[model samples]
Target: MFNLFKDESQSVNSFFLFMQSLANRNLVAEALKVSEAKYRSLLENMGLGVIYLSNAGTVISANQVAGQIMGLPLNNMVGRALTETCSRIVKEDGSVLAHEQHPAMLALRTGKPVENVVMGLFNHAQQDHTWVMSSSVPEFLPGEREPHQVFMTLTDITRRKRVEEESSLASVIVNNTGEGIVVTDQDNKIISVNPAFTILTGFSRQEVLGKRAHCFQSPKNAIKIDEALRNSRKNGNSWQGEIWHRRKNSDDFPCWTTINQVKDATGRTTHHVYVVMDITHLKKDQNRLGFLAYHDPLTKLPNRMLLKDRINHALQNARREGSQVAVLFLDLDRFKIINDTYGHAVGDGLLKEVATRIKNLVRKEDTVSRYAGDEFIVFMEDVSDTKSPATLARKLIETFNIPVEVKGHTLQVTTSVGISLFPRDGDDSDSLIKNADAAMYRAKKEGRNNFQYYRPELTTQAFEKMAVETELRQSIDKRELVLYYQPRVCLKTGNIAGIETLVHWQHPVMGLIPPARFIPVAQESGFILALGEWMVEAACRQMRCWLDERVPVNKIVVNVSAFQLLRSDFLATVERILREHELSPHCLELEINESSLMDNAEHIIKALNGLADAGMDLTIADFGKGYFSLINLKRIPAKKLKIDRSFVSEMLCNSNYEAVIRSVIALGNSLNLQVIAQGIESEAQKDKLIEMGCNLGKGDFYFPPALPDAKNLTKLMS
Candidate 1:
């Protein structure tokens, strides 16, 4: 029994030993799995590409990065021969490299490691050769002479190589070009210059470095170039023009130059490039043009420069003899209208004709010159008084009154002469010309086609005119102009026949300014065009309101200037305005000054006929005033003839004006036109007009001019 128990105990001990050995084997298997997993993770997460290949130069295993570097999938790289990834090895110049020269194959055959061998490999995925700088090392087992595998890494170098090639090409171009080229840093310091610059400027690269490009420019040219540079900054980043440059030998020459500025990514200037072309040989006529500077190129009359010289000479002679020098500044009245209506070619022809006429009108001793556009200055020496200037002025006006024929157009150009005497108006040429110009403006204000002598007060008026003009321009832009309406009553029915529009400037500080104070200035300064257009538009717009309210009004009359009527497109503008407001053309009436009807009779008649044909009413205004011949009344196409306000106001007191009024009333009746009298401020005058067979009248006695306030316009009209 003792021997059996001992055998059983031995059997239990052997079973426990067998279980311990099996547990130890399982732990060893788990450790191996964990180590291999960590190694694979390291290879996948590393930014660098890692690959292991067999000694045959074939892809064995590769990470994602390695496959991406070769522009292929990792699975494709793993099982494929290297022919799929790289077709053949190539040199840096893209020439075929010998198979023996390949680093991977060499290390395998020579039993030596190779490092850093640049190569061009064809990429199957990219379908192009990829330039890569590669370093390869042979891996060998211990005590083995031959390498079993190659450890290779790749870096792309295509972009860098292309940059080097471009730089080389640009260097060759800069050296061989004929035009001089210069580059400057942001500080305007010279940084680089082409060899052509040295050849043209006689300076080497070392001399001009770190210096301003303008340092070697001529003094006169430097000022001009500096100003141009400032303008270029304002306008754009480039400038092209001609400038004088001084070479190292101090020899000056003209050069046509183009400058281009370069800016960085952050909108800051980085550098500037200058291209220069020497133009010294091309300006052969420069000296010839100098001799013709004193004469006007268009009119061939003495220009402003020569006018000044003649004025000085006349003053010198007058001072010695104690005589007066008459400087008549003659301006063509409304010449701009001619230029605008006809083409400039016709206008130029008219100007030459006027210049010839004035030259013929003056004495041989007088210097008649074209002062500026449509202006002529005549400085007559040995003048006794203002009579000489006045006589010449009258003749000039009379001569221009006759129609000038140019380019199939008969233009009646008129003159407004301003006389300024030396030692009276001014002692110098500049002051004399300036004072004459001021007086010329006065003549235009007093109604053009007349002469005026310069007085000290004209200067004050000139300054005030300038102030008014500046403020008036602002008023137009800001829409500060307001409209006023006055009624023209029918004498037969004692009802409102027409409403005339009057413009007022509602000045911020000066209250309301009437048309009388600023109309003349507006007329002279071409602001009348804007004012006239505004008045017509405002009238048509008010008529639209009246229509909305169903007010009892016949027509709204707008006093249109000759300037507006003579516009080539005035008829179209009126038609457009009426169409916009949906108002009938007959609701608007244009009242033009009688003198303007005769001034440009041909053109005015044409424009009026167009308006009349369009179903608009036309009225000849300020009748029997100014130099109006009764013959034009027959051709005027007017529905109404308004008696001159001045003549009507003076009628009861003056017989001559009453006679003139009666004749005008008779003339209207004979021509089948309505006769309207303006400025009837008394019941007596109104009754007298009725007795004289006048149809309509307008004055304070009927209704003083007030704004057509939309809120109460219907009430006021009723």
Candidate 2:
């Protein structure tokens, strides 16, 4: 019974011990399963890839991340040889890695750990190569001297690698590009510079690094650049503009610069990148173009365009100051003759010299500009009175007194100056210039080498002249101009000897416009030649009519202007007129003024001889009023000389005038020319003229100037 009890106790004890051991073993197993589950979860869920390789470089186990990174199925990767699965592994240099050199195999071979062994793997599923950083540690079973497997963690760094490559390529471009590039930190200190920057700024990277960007900018522009950068950063943008920069040698140069902010993912400005381009040559070209637009090429003076701008500006100032502005229009006298005789080269030189002299005479505030051919304009601003322009004019005229040596020719020239004042002559540039030109024309008419101010009277005269000219141009076509006759009576018989033809303008609106009102205008406006031709034709036709009507008439005298007589075709025009009217040339007489005959005596002689040869009578009217020499008078082919109306009218009043008339009559008789006295309004005057040996007379005393119609003319003849 004791033995049975002992055996039972031993059995129970043994069972108890066995039960305890079984419990311990169950707890251990449960803990081990939990550990394995936690490890697998860590390997699968972690961002990095984890793999277990056998000693022979085969894949023993791989987590989900490991399989995905290797581009393989987890089941297929677990049994595959790691060397075969990753056969496309290569070093960063693109050289293929041997199986022994792989991180997993190397860890196993050397019984050590491998860290950060960067390599590339070919992803078969993705059909691309992926970059990874691999680290491995050898694993062994208990009591085993050799490693059984390799535990590896792989991090896919493909994006980081690609970024590094791109960074390298960008570095190359920045280094070689022609435009300079500079990188700066957030503090605006230079952090890096490319080779192009060194070439552009004459400073090396070592010299400029860590320095402020303003160090390379001029002192004048440094503050500007800083303010611009601050504004740009505040706006969260880039700034581009031109700046003047200083080089290492302290020389300044112009550059077009662009500064861009480099921001991180958070949009915080971390650095600034500067792009600079040299623009020194471009600025120079722009300045040159601007200069050429405003300056004359020949004289280097301001041109008309710039002068106009200046005048406008000056006028503005003058208006503000309550002062006057004067515009002086100057023309070189007889400059056309000089240009024709001396050639354009010499003319250009003369113009340059004239420009220089004019510039020297004017104040710095005044502008002297070439207006056009042989014309210059001076703009005077803030003038106190008219005398300012007059004084300047006198100075300019005095300057031209000295001869200018041009092309070895010592040429003396003079300028006719015409001044027009603002608010008086004109209110604008165009008007002022036009009025100045008109005044300049008046100056030329008064005689060149003088100056004249624009007058209201001159404007009125100019308008009247223009009106006459406009009317005269159409007068012939309109036939508004008709002929009037003044009978020339024989003083002894008191009978009409001849008729003097006069032109009359039968204006439609105004009453009869006298010859005095339009004759001078016609002469100056170059309309006299046409008027003279029409008068000759009309006179010839009237004579032919009278002859056909059997009216007694000795001759018809037509007054001719100097311009008409000087025309090369005058004789032909006269002959043609006579033929067209079917009149005898002997029935017509041409009266040329003494001044016309004295102007070009030789040409006048030739013309007179031609008229005489054509059987036309020639007479010199207003004979005593001109400076005619006896030699030139005798050379004239005139058969008759008419005393001036001034001498004729004053003969009974002023003895000096009577003496002059008597002397002229005597001179005419001595020259064997018939003397005719005009303005014989009284019989006493006519008798005096007859006593003075005047063969003919015509005045209101005998017959007033009447219309040359047949009725009035036939009555006067009867």
Candidate 3:
């Protein structure tokens, strides 16, 4: 309390000391000279105008850069209100330039720094010119009543802005193109992908960008694409071609694409662009047209033209390789009798079953074609010797010894085969086919099912088959193709398993069209793959639905043909159907004849193993009918054995057949095989097979072949 006066004196002393310190600042002649020199030097060097405005909004100072930006002299811009010194213009988003809001004015009013705020200045004629990205800074003096100055800096970035805008437009165009477009930088990292690429391939730009272009390749097309890309890069040019690619869904599709490499002036590659167009559908249509031109649509087999081509090619190859090839001409025994009695529908069924058997017996490397209405030609290439051809002929005769079931009837069938060997039987395709055909007639004359080799005198008889193949091609739309199903039964329980699908054809105007009628036609026409796929998908849907209902269902057996089996997408197609219908692999069994397995053993075995691992079962439909060795039979890990029906039908009557059936059963049992006796019509036959320890019997003795939705299926359970 007593020191208050002393404290007031000290405060007064401190204030004078501060004043004296500010007075030492030298804001006089020396300061003026230093500031003027610095200001002039800065103005001359800057490309933009710099301005300083007074607190009252009059220009106090101006630099050469600022004068240039406003298109006015330094003296003219000075002593003028910043707003009046420039003709103000509205900005693009529609904001007006006002004096108080201007950078210099704002700096003066608030005593704070402002940068890159746009303003307008008056030119010589009082017209305003706008300058963008200008800045203002406040200049202050010690002990002053108001801010002494505002300094401004101006720059024109319009050229840079325009370049940026053009670059943005180009980027938009690249991103929106319809063709699948990919851009890679010099380092080969993907820089961009167009919208169409994302849509077609199911990969977003974010997902693929920065990844190398080579990542999209599958092993099937990797080598070709790599070579093409490498070549294109080396030449610094463009290349175009068709390529195979797999989509994100794991489906392989065809694409026509172009690749271009971009290079710099130094001749170094800097970027690459890829344009792709999908061509899967186009290829499919081309294949369809080609198939139609040379194949029979009805049976989906190679017709006479295709057969002749194959035979001619085989002959040429045989001559070049010094190898022997044989042609076996087959004619169905008693095929007309079945057609006359059971109607053409049943006749078609018989023909289809015959085709199935014939397909089963031949090697995959061999070609079996429908020669005519009821005759077939089997071309065996790379035969080890003349004995090989004869052995195959005997196997064909044995194959027909099986019975075909149609409309609840067990019909026994046989085939007459005529054999002709390459280099031994006149060498050329026409002569060999002629000799084989002649030999088949001799077999028919000798007692129908037996075969005879051509002996020069039977040329007229051989010529008869050529006429039949020509007629079969046009017979399908003429109502010549047929459909049939053979009943399969559960081996352990003797319950109806499922039907094994088959097809046949007969011409109304031409009586019975054997498998020789339409199968060769379909195969030649390339319709077989389509037809087989249709059959499998249809059968799968029906049987899978019935099985879903838990109606005492056993696995439905579908046949996979050699053509269908060899397709690249075959597995994917099967998987798609099963997934679509919610069907389990356990509900279906695939019957691949022995011939197909032997022809592509490694791939087929791998495919079968994959299917099996996924829970689908496998069966050999016509056992003891194919050209596989006994060791091959043991090597194939099949789940069931279907005893050919011919043996079951004649077991009681033919002693030789009885012994064969016994041996088959014993061999099957020794291999832990489940044997299903097909064509068990009479009670006597069923008892005989049951006594022989056959696991199950199908045919008239049980229930007739029925649809999966049959109402009376439960009645035959026992």
Candidate 4:
């Protein structure tokens, strides 16, 4: 047993020496086998797929990963042609690649390394394509010029490739969308803008690449939009609303904008996206529709609907202030007659003129609305008393005194105004307007050219005036209006200087009516304009007859109403009348009240200047009563200032009245104007006026106004 152990030990030593000798010469086949096994194990266990191919294109070996990537068994992949195993390989574009273009073949042919060559593999089991990124290296024998085999590494990247493709498509859609899109980073700095953003805002990418999104917002809506964005980000939701945005040119326009937060996997906001669409045209259409609903189409004034709304508001305000609201209902007197005489075109012009006049006379807070067919309603808030409405009514009535010239025809129109006060006549809008309308009918009955308050007793009087208006309308055609003359004796010469022509209504049944009673009715019925023209012609003819009789009168002074003076062709009419009678222009004086001249100062200046230029004398009658500015008085081309009868009649009893008369005379004299006093019924008043440097005087004390005949003129001269 000892000898056997000794032999075994020697054999062991021999084996060790022999292994050592093989190690030293590096020629042990066992060592080569172990190294091959280690390399095989590493290749099989590696995360990457590994394949070994012969230079002839046949697959020599493949690891489990490679077989799995190709959807085949490892043993089945071995010894197979690499090109046949992956015959369905394609480029990223889905086009099939030839065998010679494969990574392994390319590496062998070039004798170099190829990396990251992406290819698609058909998975027969799944019947779908799998994308792989492959890298290959050529293997060469020692001292050989050609590669013997190729080593390839592949990675299954189908999921990553799909994600990249989808991301690229999403980017295209975002860039080309019609709505303006802006993207901002976590810091709220703009990072990207779509093509539509640049187009919509008129800003280029270079101009606003890094600008804050709020930089494009309008000042009016900047704070609102910023708050919305903040709230949206806090809630991790999108905000959508209309906002006003500014363009690069500084124009502000409405836009519908949406802001959305882009969040990460952890639900933390990383970026914000903004989208916008213009809405300017839509807003304009909405506003236009709203305006058209409440406004009148013809005059662009408030219609009945709007008037009612204003009246309600006024009533509310009046109630709060403990003040009164006045509702004035007006109807054009005899408007139909003018319309029938001159056609509807002239009538429309007259109505428009009347509307303008009424608007000019009222306060800014008042509302003047066309009720219907020559009818208008005015609503006044916070009226102090009945005086306010009465004053407004008088001003409105005076507006018709000026003639409205339409297509060469001089038209006169007056309004019969009826007023109803809040809480006094009625409280509500409907009740006030209804009562005011009833009062207006009463005014038409009393006289066509006057105003009346809403009183229970006025209804009967209104019917009576309506009857009188009908009679007055017929009086003009029947030639019942006659001229009466009042002689004016010169205070310095004591000679008849002029005769004032006045209108008298000779109503056949009512007997000889005073000028005040029927004159207003005539003016309201638009008969005043015709009657005025007739008086002018008649006075000129009468003056010529007086001149033929060798009377002492040198001039004929005619009282002109506001209506006659407003006529566009008034100067022409006066000239024609004088020419027809062969009377000199210097012999006719036009007397206009100061209130009438001041009502429309600009237009009146032109008319008065035209009359002065035509060699006719112009006189301002009833001067002190009107609120006339000195500058306007200077603009008026008048030769005479007539002291109002109110001042002259009371001068004897009141020193204040005497002082006013003296001041007026001094003012007229200072301005080189002749002063005349009227209604000097007492010797004391006449003596007081003469002592105040008055230039002319005429009243009942001299002689009562009588018919324009030779005998009355001779008596005035005597």
Top-down TM-score ranking: 1, 2, 4, 3
In the range 527-618, model 2's lDDT, one tens digit per residue, is 88788999998889888888887888978999997677666788999999889878788889999888766444565677788889999999
The TM-score of candidate 3 is: 0.36
**Can you write out model 1's per-residue Cα lDDT over 1-718, one digit (the tens) per residue?**
7989999999999999889988888898888889878877887787556666687877777777677667788887886766656667689877898776877667767767676677777766777776777666778899877778877666667677678768988888888888899999987789999999999999999999999888667765744656655665776888888888889999988888878888999978898888888887677557547646888887788888988998888788788888898888999987877887777899899989988998898899888888878889988888877688888889988997789999888777778888899898999999998899889888987878999999999989888889998898788788889988888877877778878988999989888999889887787678888888888898999898887878888688999988898888899999999999998888999988887866667778888888999998999888877677667667767889989889888889999989998998998899999999988899999988898889989888877887777544446587
Q: Give lDDT tens digits, candidate 4, residues 287-389.
A: 8778778876555567788999998888887888888999999999767556654578888887787888889999998999988778899899889878999
Of the candidates numbered 1 and 4, which has the greater lDDT value?
A: 4
The numbered model that scores best in TM-score is 1
Candidate 3 C-alpha lDDT tens digits along 487-543: 666544665666665555565566655454456445534566766776677777766
Candidate with maximal lDDT: 2
* Shift in Å, residue 126, candidate 4: 93
Go through the candidates in order and give the clash count of each: 0, 0, 31, 9
lDDT of 1 at 568: 86
Model 2 CA deviation exceeding 4 Å by range: 1-307, 320-323, 330-377, 381-385, 392-417, 437-451, 456-461, 598-602
**TM-score per model over all chains:** 0.58, 0.52, 0.36, 0.45
Question: How well does candidate 4 score on lDDT at residue 618?
Answer: 90
